[model samples]
Target: LSDPFVIIELLPRHIFSSCVEQQTVVHKRTLNPVFDECFEYSVTLEQCRAEGAMILFTVMDHDVLTFNDFAGEAYLSLNQIPGVDRGTSNADNFHGLKEIELNLMHQRDREHPILKTLESRLGDKAAQDFMKKCRERVTNF
Candidate 1:
């Protein structure tokens, strides 16, 4: 088993590709990790809903010498998240939803750069199938 952490990438409208990024502390040697981390990005409501806005959650293994391993990832639309799509007010902020659980998954395409790398290291069939099941099971409300 390997230590794992989470990386959050936020791309707002007209912003550079690598604008805002955050990461959670590494959790050692566990498949299920619990993280109590917070991230804040200053973006207006209009920017949040813009077509260029994208939120990516990437799960990676913490490696010391070699490159980190990609476990899974999920693409989140800020518009789909509850309370985020609401009007510009305190109510829209993620206040009561302190323990929001988002399930991240591997990308579906075998040709995807991350997934390709993951498959090459972990073998193709089993890992890809597992990821497909995870994606189907996750329900965003």
Candidate 2:
């Protein structure tokens, strides 16, 4: 197994853009990694609803000489968060920890430019195979 890390981005969709972007520390050489990590983003509920924000989770393999490998990707919406409700779009409704499950596979419905770039860098076949392993290996977190 390779050392792995997670890159998380909270990007606002459409007119609204750029907000929270962060990454977790790399776990060294483990098939099963437990990351009891926490991250806070200062995004208002109003902004989230108006922009239709998406949380992008990119799992990558850490490498020294060569470029890191793209393991898998999962996407989440701010609206899907426990406290946030789309119907109300109330700022007061935002609070607390929500357990979000990432898809861990290529989402054909929407285009992911980052994934395409990573695949191009790693070669299409290599990226596809690695991502497949990531999907099989990682079910939930």
Candidate 3:
């Protein structure tokens, strides 16, 4: 870690690791509330190693004793693939920005109450493609 303070500046959401001291070069990525909170993370460790981040620690998902506590062993698996932050969009509009939001939400909640309506409303396929990619990325991790 550059500085304990600098690590805070990183605001690591999709990740947490003891390897911060090993000089982690975090990838730029967005955050989503639902997936970020739900699953134990499996960010790619190989990418960070390729990017010059050496592992000093790790935390495995299954070893994560509680909802939050994970084995430090898995912390070495810190690299993340790009654009995998949120799996599927759950927004609500996309003929425009409004519709785009709806498109994302609909994908996120293909079965949500309000989102059923939003899915019915969107016309573009692009957002769905992106969301599909998101789902695949999430599955891979």
Candidate 4:
């Protein structure tokens, strides 16, 4: 049994400084956890239209005595979201809610181009630190 939680990150394609992050409450002692939650980001429609803007969902197993373990991750592009591509649309104007189901990948793609680019940012302390934390979360068990 594992205590699982989810971290949601909104990231711009080329700018890491503007990243917005949120997390779900940990669901204790269950491999199958239901995180019925909603997160709203203070992002503009322009930001949503920006190329490569995406939301990353990372699931982690909570641990009291040691580092949390990575369970899985999913990525969704802002462009693909409903009401995002529509003109002059507000949440209230969007009558129905669109539910998105994503398949989680159990393993991290170490050789991904984005990961490589982030890894190459040796001069950027923030990027380096972010990558370091991500690397540390690689499943060892």
Q: What's the CA RMSD for each of the models? A: 9.8, 8.8, 18.7, 3.5
**Tens-digit per-residue lDDT, 1-141, candidate 4:** 999999998775355456668899999999889998889877777788787778889999999998888988889988777668666555555458677899988655677788789889999976887688678779431
Ranking by lDDT: 4, 1, 2, 3
Task: Provide the global lDDT of candidate 3 against the true structure.
Answer: 0.29
**Between candidates 1 and 3, which one is better according to lDDT?**
1
Give the per-residue lDDT of model 2 (tens digit) for 16-51. 345546899999989778777888777666766655
Model 3 misplaced stretches (Cα beyond 4 Å): 1-110, 113-122
Ranking by TM-score: 4, 1, 2, 3
TM-score of every candidate relative to the true structure: 0.63, 0.62, 0.17, 0.76
Error of 2 at 58 (Å): 0.5
The digit string of per-residue lDDT tens for model 3 on 1-141 reads 111110111113223343223222222232321221112233353334344332223221221243322212222222332222133532232223221111121123335554344435457464454345334423321
Count of residue pairs whose backbone atoms collide, per candidate: 0, 0, 29, 0
Report lDDT per candidate: 0.67, 0.66, 0.29, 0.80
lDDT of 4: 0.80
Alpha carbon deviation, residue 48, candidate 4 (Å): 0.8
Judge candidate 2 at residue 22 and give its lDDT: 84
Cα lDDT tens digits for candidate 1, 78-130:
77666456654454456665444667675445456765565455565656654
